[model samples]
Structures are given as structure tokens and as C-alpha cells.
Target chain A: MKNPIDNLNKVFDSRIRLGVMSVLLVNEEINFNDLKDLLQLTDGNLASHLSHLEENGFIKVRKGFIGRKTNTTYSITKAGEKAFKDHLAGLENMIKSIK
Target chain B: MRSKEESLDALQDIRKMMERSSRFISLSGWSGISAGICALLGAWFGYGVLARTGGESVSASSRTSQVGLSSMGEIQQLLLIGRLTFAAAAVSAFIFTYIRSKKNAIPMWGLTAKRLLINTMVPMIVGGLVILRMMQTGYYDLVGSCSLVFYGLALVNASKYTLNEIRYLGYAELALGLIDLWQRGYGLLFWALGFGVLHIIYGTMMWWKYERVQSK
Candidate 1:
């Protein structure tokens, strides 16, 4: 199989997105605002990154009402999880090969 | 009435804030160093207390072995020292955190303190009372494990108010408690691992990832 990192959609390639992915991978599900605060990114910037990841089908975004307030929660899709794991493996391999 | 668009925008803003807040920033590096120092000192004191009081008498492989805290001849002094050392280390962490916050204009004490106190105290107080009752009833055997279990409960219960790192700490403590439940008689070692090693590991990780880079 091709190295998963080789096929990593550069669509979700930014540092913030990578960070968001890492956090989401560890946590079962996280809301949109929590991701922004954790990453310390502005609203528009986070929105754009989320939009990009959503477009790539790497993340599933849900919009619903949370206690009379509209809530948006994001979770990693199966594809996203596989991609992340593969990405980490590929990065490890690349690092090992570097030396 | 406010327009639907305005409400949607506001909700969007709240969501953004929540995401930003969700990332867990670990305890400062100094906090780890302080906690480790506390744990070691506490252990050393504990050892000394036990030694002076004729030391902790653990039978070779007993699960429900009694802890000989009553024979305080050599152990009393050691216990005193351990208590002092642990107290000092905890105080140092508080002081260090306070100083850092003051220098950075971060509000460390008020809300964080309130939350931590609520988290640390509720279960801790209840656990402390229970342990005291147990000890009075000659159940010194269960004190150590109770400490671990209640401490974990405190962390888990209070994890919602502040940084998510606390939740992990809670889980680690819970693991330690389970280890205690088996009553393998490795009391001191488990205490050190749970209170000392874990803090240092978490602290160092936090320092490396966030504080170090920011201060640079």
C-alpha cells in the first residue's frame, strides 16, 4: 500500500488543522469553539480550516441546538482516523529514513 | 426580538470560544518539580516515621495486612518529616504559580483557585473524614488506597471547570487507586508514582509544549 502520508490531502495541511486533527483524534468528539480556543485561532480562520477539512470528508460536522443555543460538534470520520494514523506512521518512517 | 441571523452569529462566536478553551495546557514545569519534591519529601518523611516507630511492618505477601502505625517509636518522627516535606512542596507549587501569574498578569488565583478548591476539597474532605473514621476504627490498612481513590474522584469531578489535562490526571489517579485495591502492599512506591512521577511527567510535557515556547 502507498504510504498514507503520501496521499494526505494537503487540503487539511495547515498547522492549525493538524493540531485540531491531533486533538480530535485523541478526544472522542469536540465542539467547534473548543478547537479554536485550544488552537488559539480567530473565528474566521478556524471556520475556514473546518470547512476545508469537512470538504475533504476527513471530519463530520454536526449542527444542532444545545440548550436553546445552536451547537456545532465535530468528530473524525473513519477515513480521517485512518488517515491520521497512517500520517503518523508515514511521518515516523520518514523520520527514520532521514538518518 | 433579535433576528435569527444575529442569534446564529452569536452562537458561532460562542462555539469559537469553546474550541479555543478546550485545548489542555498542562501544569507548569516548576509545578512538576515542586510536586516531585513534595512526594519525595513526603516519602522520605514517611520512611523515617516508619523507621523511628519501628518502620512499616509489611508481611512478605499479605493482601489485607495491617499497617503498624500505632508503634510510633521510630515512625512518628518520620511521619512528621514526611508531612512537613509534602506540605512544603505543595506550598511551593502554589507560590510558584502565584508568582508566575503575577508576572504575566494572568488571573491564577481567583477563579482557578475556586475551581481547584471545589474540585480538590469536596471529595478530599469527604475522603479525609472517612479515612479518619477508618483509622479510629483500626482500619489504617485502607487509608492509602482511599487517598488514591478519593483524590482521583476529586480530579474527575472537578475536571470540567478548567483545563482538560485535569481529567487525565483524574484517570491516572483512578488507575493508581485500582492498583491499591489489589492491596499488593507496595504503598510507598504507589504513592510516589501517583503523586510524584505523574506530576513531573505532566508538568514537563506542559512546559515543553506550551510555556517553554511561549517564554522563548
Candidate 2:
């Protein structure tokens, strides 16, 4: 018998990363500040989680300047969307199995 | 291993965050309520103007007992009153929405809000221009219905970026506008029903559903 836990993506195991993916899935592109505000995460914590997702090729980052200030925006890749959906299915299945 | 409750809580949190990112959820119920009150007051003022103008024409031309159409000056005065009332309502609505957004720690200006504003304003602007033209050509009977229909379209257009419940209000407005069109000569009554009564009902429901819980 295969373990249901195997369906859950390892990258999405962290709540913060999951949160970042969830927000990215709904929006076309979100700036770093808006992400931070939505997730309610500290600057360093959000940056670290973003880098991890970027390294995994789940999201793409675009750095630009709005006025004199640097603005970084993030968007989800197709891979990210598929992975998040799978992970969500896994979660739903897990809940279903419990009931 | 995380417990089921923890997982469920995380799921709920994710859902909320996603919704927040895509939707302008900071619209306050008070904005709708104040707008309703303003519409009612405007309707009352408009009724008074019409009555006074009609009474004046009756008194001036005793031979023709029929109420004559208002003069250009009287019409201009009524239009000015309508514009002032609309401006007051808009400002009050903005103030209430700003306060609610601040209290909720949501940015009042953002991508979702910008989209909502653009979508809502496009229909309203078109409707305003059309109404103005209709007034110029003396098709005043259709003015109230056109305003309601266009305003309904605006709300429906903008509803995609805000709470889904707003769509119902849009539909209600559209229905009222259509009914008003069918039943002419009661434009002001339908305007009161659409803007005043409908807004108060929607605002009360929204407050009960969203804000009341938060207050507790």
C-alpha cells in the first residue's frame, strides 16, 4: 500500500511556502511588500522562503524599480501550480481518509 | 506529524490569504448605508423641486391647469442639487471605506482596488455622458432608469474584484431599472427603491455577515 503522505510535496510542507504559493496562485503578479503584508511574515523570513521557492523553479522573481525604490515581484510557474494542486488534493484525501 | 486540526487551520489560513490577495475585501458596510441615506435625501429634495416647479407653473398660467414642464433655469438648479448630493454621498462612502481598510490593516490602494475602480468608473462615466445627452435632448423620463441601469452595470463590472455579494445588489439595481423603464412616470419612486432601500438592505446584511463578527 502506498502512503498517502507521499502525495504531499516536500516544498509545500512549510506553512510559509504554502502561503506564498497560495497567494501567487490567485494573483497574476504580486509585489514583495504585498506578499509580506498578506502573509504577515518578517522581511528576512519571507525573503528566505521566496529564495527557496525560486531555487526549486516553482516561482519566478522580477526585480524592478518603482520610482527610486527597488521593487521585487513574484509569480507562480506552471510547475508551481501543478504541485500546489497536487498537494491540495493530498490534503483533501488525507482529510477524507480520516472521516 | 501535524494533527488534522492543525492541517485544517493551515488550509483555512491559506484560503484567506489567497482571497485577500485577489479581492478588495475592505469595503465597509457603512459606505453603503451612508450612500443609501444620501439617495433617499436626494430623492426627497428632487421631489420637492418638482412639486414646487409644478405649483409655480399652475399658479402662473391659471388657464392651463396642467403642470407645465420646468424652465431651463429650474432644471439647472435641480441638476446642481443632484450633483451636490451625489458628491456628498461619494465622499462619505470613501471616508467610511478608508476607515474600515485602516482598521483592518489592508492597504486602501492596491492592484485589486485599482482594477475595481477602473471597471466601476467606466460604466458610470459612460452612463453619465449618455444621461447628459438625453437631458439635453429633453428625454428626461429615461434619465432615472438609465442611471440605475448603468450604475448596476458598474457594480456588476466591479464585483469581480470585490465581495461576491455585491453582484446581488447589482442584479437588484438592474431589475429595478428595467421595471422603471416599463413603468414610466414613477422614475423617482424606482430610484428611491433601487438606490435607497436596496442599499440599506445590502449594507445591513453585509454588516451582519462580515463586520458584526469582527466586532465581537
Candidate 3:
């Protein structure tokens, strides 16, 4: 048997990343403002975590305009979804083993 | 290995986040209550029109008087009342839902809401078209029952995106519709029961379950 924690993605270590991924998993995409509102995070903090996910290719960014204002939306990539799901599976396994 | 408790907490957190993001739970129980009131009011008005048309037993005898509404004027009048009632209920529900979402700090038109609307609307739209065709073909007796059935399906379809209580309401409507199918002539009565009475009951239950507990 293998240790489940070892199989966890290191990028998911932060709670914000976990939250972002979780939100994206259920939604097709979320605009920056809406995501910020959902997470209740300050602009700088959300930006940093979002950039981190983007850097790791765990999420994709789409920049478009809603009339005059530019809107930036985020959605989980296939890799991101798989990684999050795997992380979840690992968590589930840990529970099963302990029980 | 980490303790089971720690893993459990993480799993709970994940479940919460996913559910919140995916489901539109901001719908106020008041939405149901108001919609039910509107439906009941509509039924009363419809009954009035039926009475004025010299069709005393709008609930029974008159339905068998002929295949459908006796005259185009009567159909138009009943339809107008029905449409008004539906519009009133919808608007009221939307207003209540919007206010509740605002209070809860949830986005009103998010993807979850969009999905909910789309899922519910598809069935409702199909049902609407089918019912219209029935009206044209003089199958008025079946209209009320079918509406109940279709409305039930729409709610059941959208239940995943909203409160679980609605699913039960949907089920009740579906059951009533099925029973009304064989009963015939009783379409008006069943429609009132399914749309009017059932809504009030469902709305009250929802309010008691969610709003009462939360507010108090």
C-alpha cells in the first residue's frame, strides 16, 4: 500500500488553490469578479493564487469584453480536473483505510 | 499516515465548495409561497370565467359537454387568465429569489442559475408547445393534467440545482397529473390541486424547513 498524501498534488497545498479548483470544477467558467466574490478574497490574494494555477496549467484564462469592461474568466483545464479528482480520490482512500 | 479525522475534514470542505459552486441554493422559500398564492388566485379567476360561461361544473360535467372548450371566446378568456396567473407567479418568484440571493451574497445569474433555468425551461417549453397544439386540436380536457405533468418534470429536472424540497413537490405534481389523466373532466380540480393547493403546501413546508430555522 502507498501513502495517500504522497500522491497528492503539491500545487494543491494551499487552501486558495484548492478552493479555486473546487469552484472551477463545478462551473464551466467564472469571471474574475464573480470568482473573487465567491471566494471572498482581496484582489491581490486572488490574483496571486490565480496566477499560480495558470502557471501550472491547472486552469485556463479567457479574456473577453462584456461591452466596455474587459472580463477575464477562469475555467479548469482537463489536467486540472484530473488532478483535482485524483487528489479527491486519494483523500477518499485515506478515509477508507482508516475506517 | 494522517489521521482519519483530518482527511474527513478535507473531504467535507471539498464537498461544500463543489456544492456551493454548482448549485443555486439562494432561492428563498418565499418564492414558493408567493408562487403558490399566485396560482391559487389564478384558479379562482379561472373558476369565475367558467361559471360565467354557463358551464357550472367546470370541474366535471362541463368537460364532458363536448371534447374541448365550447367556444373560441371561452378558450381565449380562460387562456388569458391562465397566462396572467403564470406570469404573476413567475415574476413574484423571480423577485423573491433575487432578493434572497442578494441577502446571501450569491450571484443571481451565475452558471449554476443558468444551468437550472435551462434544465427547467427545456421541458416547460416543450410542454407549452404540446399544450398549444392540444388546444388547437380541441383536447382541452387533457390540457390541465398535461400541464401539471410537464410542470412536474421541469421542477424535477431543475431540482438538482436548487432546494431538495422542490423535488418532492415535483413528484406530487407528477402523481396528481397521472391520476387526473384517467379521471378526465376533473382536470380543473386536479390543476388546482396540483398547481394551487400543492404549491401552497410545498411552499409552507419549504418556508418552515429552511427560512424558519435560519431566521430564528
Candidate 4:
């Protein structure tokens, strides 16, 4: 039997990272400021979490200019979605086992 | 190590953040209240114009079988007043929404806000054009009903992008429009009830539900 704990993705272990993934799952694309505002995270903290997700290839980033201002947007990848679902399943299984 | 309760709370928080990011929630109750007051005032002014012209028509027809002021002239004046009232209400609504967004530290011109405006404006623009054409062809009696119906449609269409409670207001306006259509001559009264009274009630409910608790 596989350990349910093994199914929890380390990349999404942080609450902030989990929050980011949760937001990106629902929204097609979200700009940086919106994510920052929603998560209530400092600039440095959000940037580092985004970098971690980017390095893991779980989220894609697009940087562009909007009327002379640089805009950064983030979206979840297919891999990210699958990982999130598996994590949720693991959580449910763990709870069921406990009950 | 996080406890089960902590994990569950984190999940809930994430869900809320996702919902907040995707949906526009900066709509102010003050916008509805101001619009309602404007609509009431506009209805009063409309009543004044109608009474003056109606009295003139009756007395002039009895005396000389002709109206003192041409029916066309009266209609033109009423149309102008309607336009003015609509403009005032729209401006006030915009101002209140802008103020609320600023207060909430939310961008007023975000993607969701743009989508909401576009969806709401499309039906309103089409309705305005149709009403203007009707006025040109002297179908003044149908103007009130058409405006109400179109405005209701606009609200319903835009409700997907904003608070869902607005859909109820849209339904009420649509029902009022249909009733006005059947009643024919009581357009102003129905308009007042639909726009004036309904908006105030909606505004009060929204304020009580959303704003009052926040301030407390």
C-alpha cells in the first residue's frame, strides 16, 4: 500500500504556494498585482514563491508591457493541475483513514 | 506540523482567495441608492411635464380644438429630460463605483471591471438606439416599456461579472416593463416603481448585508 503522505506534493507544501496554485486553477491568467493582493503577500515573498513554482515547471509566467508598464501574469500548467488533484485526493484519503 | 484544522482552514482560505481574484466584488451600495434617488427625481419631473402638457391639451382642445404647445414639442422636451436624467444617474453610478474601488484599494479598470462594463453597455446601447428610432417615428407610448426591458436585460447580462443579487433587480425591472406594456398610459408610475423603489430596496439590502458589517 502506498503512503498517503507521499502523495502530498512538496512544491505546494507552503500555504502561499498552495494559495497561488488554487487561484491559478480557477483563473485562466492572473496578473502579479492581483495575486499579490489576493494572497496578501509581500513583493519579495510572492516573487520567491512564484520562482519556486516556475522552476518546478508547474506554473508558466508571461512578462510583457502594458502601456509602458511591465506586466507579469501567471497560469497553471497541466502538470500543476494533476499534482493539485492528487494532493487533494491524498488529503481526503488520509482523513478517511483517520476516521 | 500543521493540524487537520489548520490544513482545512488553509484550504478554505485558498478557495476564498481564488474566488476573490476571479470575481469583481468592489461594487458599492451607494451607487444603487444614488441611482434610485435620481430615478425618483426624474419621475417627479416627468410627472410635472406630463401634467402641464396634459392640462394644456385638454383646455386648448375644448376652446379651439387645437393644442397650445404642439404634441411634437412636448415629446421632444420629455425626451430631452429623459436623456438628462439618464446621464445624471449614469454619472453618479460611475462616481460611486470609482470611489468604492479606490477605497477598497482595487483597480477600477481591471479586466473583470472592463468585461462587466462591456456586457452591461451592449444592451443599453442597442436599447438607446431603438428608443431613439421609436421617438423619431412617434411611438412615444412604448418608450418607457422598452427602456425598462432593455435596462433589465443589461443588468442580467452583466450580473455574471458582478454580484449575483443584481439579477433579481433585473428580473423585477423586466416584470415591471411587461406590466407597463399592458397598462399603456401608466408608464411613469411603473417606471418610478421599477427604477426608483426597487433600486432603493436593493441598495438598502446590499448595504445592510455587505457594508454595515464591514464598518462594524
| Candidate 2 residue pairs that clash | none
Worst lDDT run of 10 residues, candidate 3 chain A, spans: A1-10
- Evaluate model 1 with DockQ and give the value: 0.04
Each model's TM-score?
0.56, 0.88, 0.80, 0.81
Query: Which window of 10 residues has the lowest lDDT sum in candidate 3 chain B?
Result: B60-69
Give the least accurate 10-residue stretch of model 4 chain A, judged by summed lDDT: A90-99
Ranking by DockQ: 2, 3, 4, 1
**Backbone collisions counted per model:** 23, 0, 0, 0
| Model 4 complex DockQ against the native | 0.44
Question: Considering TM-score, which of the candidate structures 3 and 4 is the better prediction for this target?
Answer: 4
Error of 2 at B23 (Å): 1.2
For candidate 1 chain B, which ten residues in a row score worst on lDDT?
Answer: B55-64
DockQ of each: 0.04, 0.61, 0.51, 0.44
Interface RMSD of each: 14.3, 1.6, 2.1, 2.6
Alpha-carbon lDDT of model 2: 0.84
**lDDT of candidate 3 over A26-73, digit per residue (tens):** 888898987887777999999999999999999999999999999999
At residue B75, candidate 3 shows an lDDT of 71
- Please report the interface RMSD of model 3 to 1 decimal: 2.1
lDDT of 3: 0.83
* Total residue pair clashes for candidate 4: 0
